[model samples]
Target chain A: MKKSIDAKKGKGPKAKLSNDQLLTLYRNLVRADHFDKCYVRRIQAGQLISFYHAGEGGLAPGVGACSFLRKEDILWPHHRAHAQGHMLSKGIDLKYYLAEHTGKTTGCCKGRSSYHWSFPEYGVFGTSGCIGAGFSPTVGWGLACKKNGDGQITMMCCGDGGSNRGTAHESFLMANNWKLPIVYLIENNGLAIFSKHEDMHPTKDIADLAKGYGMPAVIVDGQDVIAVAEATLKAVEHARAGKGPYLIEAKTVRIQAHGVGLPDLVDYTPRSKEEIDELRERDAILICRERLLTEGLLSQELIDQIEAEATQEVADAERFADESPVADQLDLSDINKLVYAE
Target chain B: MREITLIEAIREAYIEEMQVDEKVFLVGQDIRGGNFPNTTGLVEMFGDDRVLDTPISETAMVGSAFGAAQMGYRPVVDFMSGGFAYVAACEVLLQSAQHYFQHGGNVSVPLVITAGVGAGLKLANEHSVTPHAMFLHHPGIKVAFPSTPYDAKGLMKSAIRDNNPVCMFWHLALMMEKGQVPEEEYLVPLGVADVKREGTDVTVVATGLQVKHALEVAANLESEVSVEVVDLRSMEPLDYEAISRSLEKTNRLVVVDEDTERCGFAAELIAQVVDKSFDLLDAPIERICIDNMPIPGGYLEAHVLPNPAKIETAIRRVIA
Candidate 1:
């Protein structure tokens, strides 16, 4: 049986991250929230056309966990904005992300892939449009890391819906058997678009599924960046020590509609206005801000300054995306060139 | 030259490729157990680290290979049989095939998916299939079907070295068939065709096991019909030029394939030939392909598959 460690209850030891690091984590949470809100505004204004999933409440898991990874360590992100926001926090240029969104030649993927941006130079190997597809490749990356004896761990993010895929289980078995240094981070936001965890899955806890594979599993409150960082630190340490793959299920809530305030968002998500408000009150950025203020790690003035800077950064990114050139019309001769490598 | 079977030739290519490139590794089901003769001793040679025996997870294995290839490793994934390609169709077609192009030609997937194909073994509906047509239809992937031991070694080497994803279908019936393979290293380029027999009366384009049958038919009709056999070693980068050149000499054509008659490789080949050099044709193109139906078990399997007699009949009909 797998032992379930919950960081929300503060059951385990506190995270060893310094006060400066904690402040940085809080700042990233604010930045991710701001970035998401900017994208939402852009979409509403018809300035940006995108499949936008708001990462309001789920910023901590993405931002905090990614902070522990090294430059060589790879991150296989999911299609959600939380993962993209994590990439942004990891210093992936805001211009590249915005440019890719606008289908510009200056995009990270050269306007080829819109949301599924891959910058291997920044250790962001790639993300897949298909659910559960990224798991296997992350395992492969882990295998490569193990063979090279590079001590570079691979962190793969998947939703609760994607975790139910056969590929995820297969990856778990393979990673476990080979003892590949990989962290299967399940961002259990309790919603698979419209379907809730209780409706879609049999087990109450997503981490419990790891028991059958005999892998170490943990459950953490994704709203708490410190808890997430602590859980992730444990998982990363276990993997780096060659103790095999570890599973961390960060239980959080999706604060907004699945994508861009679709007409079916309210019809599909049967949550009351009161319940939605209650969920919003537990938002990670809000919680982190409160915690930072209480612990004397950040002042209201500094927090306001950080928010202003982040808003300005988003404005700058929008300008960069607007100024970036779109890809030129392809010649018939060059049509087949992109199909195969030179 | 060394006399080796098709399976031996495949095994030798893996051995040589793995011996030279540390990045080259094998991953599949029962590879360590050596259930498939082609990958029999690879585990013993390379050990478990390199020759990984994966669980019965086709999607995971293929997807992992695609990922590893992106990470600068040449992964040779064995699906055990071509029938399993259906199970891994999404990963092969969507992930591996589309990765290079979808990334704006920025990434390369050096993945070789080796599977035993064709329907002569009577392995029932699930196991018996010649589905190279499905892969050949895709744009980014390079599909190869080697009929002879020599071509098998050379093509396998080239497929491993090539940057694109290559789906290599080894006909099950021809696995043990012996053919002369040069001891020195040689690569059969992906899009090239070899003329097994040259004649003026008719031209036959055949792939995989059908290539052997086409050659046999050409030899049997030596006195009756002067037949030219063009072995299409690679299916995707199809040697249409070679077929058109052969058609220049022999204006009649008989295309032989193990796949079904409807919308298959043979049909595609004929269409391309007609498009390129329709005026050169002295007669209508004849396609010797398997009847469009599920391959039955036992004796009926032989009847459904394309044979030398079928090739000869098609050749005679086209030439007449």
Candidate 2:
């Protein structure tokens, strides 16, 4: 019998309550929310340079899936990556990411790849802006994991739009053929930029595509952290048991506009203020807080403490970005340092 | 001591390297029977896993090789022709070339992309393009255009072992041309040049199949003019040492190429000479390249390629 890890009340493992572990989860989610809020504000203030609108609210599936894994498990995030990276604290470097946005020397890529080209050492091999491009590399990493005999599973987070790409299909085929340990999580946020899921596929569930590859698929309410975490935990367990790969279609809502750009100002088919207000009440972080408080697991004082710490953390990250030194090298010849010289 | 076709030399190199290192593998279309005979007898000798056949997707093939290289595998990808290189350009330029720099030196791409090129046999417009200039312009890539079987075998071995992405072009016209090669394993490093013939009157520089034509032209003009022939084995990071030395020894110069004259290899060579060593030349540099037009197949090829007679005429004009 596997040892049950003590988690929040009505969350993770059924029995139990350690204030520390529960606090860790609560703090992580709050930090993630703080990071996303900071990121959006920076983009709005012209502080974040590479502002690609992948839509708001698409960060839940990544956060939920990553919350269950150990530090060793690598993640490959698609375009909407700030929340995912923040969840793992691997991509929480505000200075480097801000520099990357501003096309500054202090950026992660040294100003070479601005918005779309991402590289976060925090276990993110990099985000694929090319729709389904992340799929192949994710499968390759999963294959590497199998060959190395490492129990680490790679989680690839993609959007509903990327599900229709050929690379996605190919990755599924290759992952199943090789029996790689990977969890393919599709954040089905209802729309692919402008086109809705109904306008794209006949079957409402994005997991239907996984059937063609002979891989097991599941669907869950992405807004519910407990549900999302449970589904991801099950998938991770399956992969850890060497049962091959699995897919999870996370149904979530992106309350914010795609990005902090022109879309925020212009109205395409403008939603009513009331509809937007109704969606705002379903904020994942707020829902988690309410659930914990309602179940007597968390107090108002604890929630306030978590929020304060998250605010301070975000403030420190901003200062680090402000003071970080810029990379001065002109020629990138030294970039081939580790590669074999022929 | 042994004679082999252009493809056979490459096959021998692949066999020699695979036997030496288990990390090397071949992936491409129809390589089982050696698609273009470049990988002949490899599948049988190495088995299917090592010399695996791939689907007709160039992007996947190149991207897979890039991924494989990152995972400690040295992949040798063979495209049938230079035109097909365009299909794999994204993986080559964007992914393979940029990863080393983008990953902050955390990864390396030890992959060699090989293709047959040039315009003499007139395989027609699509097949016969000498797309060397495009590759030469890109940074972080090594371009090898071998004119002889010996150079092909040696340079290919170097390319396979290279850490960065390397493109080796084997001319279709020089596929059957025989040259002396040592039986032992040896490698000609990238950005090196070979002197095909020595002379003191006019330095005629060429690449790929053009090396043979330039040598033939030099021989034909033995009495009238002493023509030195230089073969640029690698295109990018060109061996300017050999060009400068040839120019210093021979006052007049002529650059012969199978591709069109506009924005061709010759144009760059001339620019380099002007920038670095213009005073060493006695006369204006002459360029003997094919006219600006698509290569025509069949008998029309005779007029499309820079032949010995054309190179000879260009050399005479430079000396006059």
Candidate 2 residue lDDT tens string, A189-212 = 776665677888788787877767
Local accuracy of candidate 1 as per-residue lDDT tens digits, A92-170: 7767877877788887778877766767877776666788888777767888878778688888888888998888888
For model 2, residues B28-96, the per-residue Cα lDDT tens digits are: 788888768888888889887678666666665665566667667787888888888786565677667
Q: Best lDDT goes to which candidate? A: 1
| Native-referenced Cα lDDT, model 1 | 0.83
State how far residue B177 of model 2 sits from its true place (Å): 3.7
TM-score of 2: 0.85
**TM-score of every model?**
0.96, 0.85
- Give the top-scoring candidate (DockQ): 1
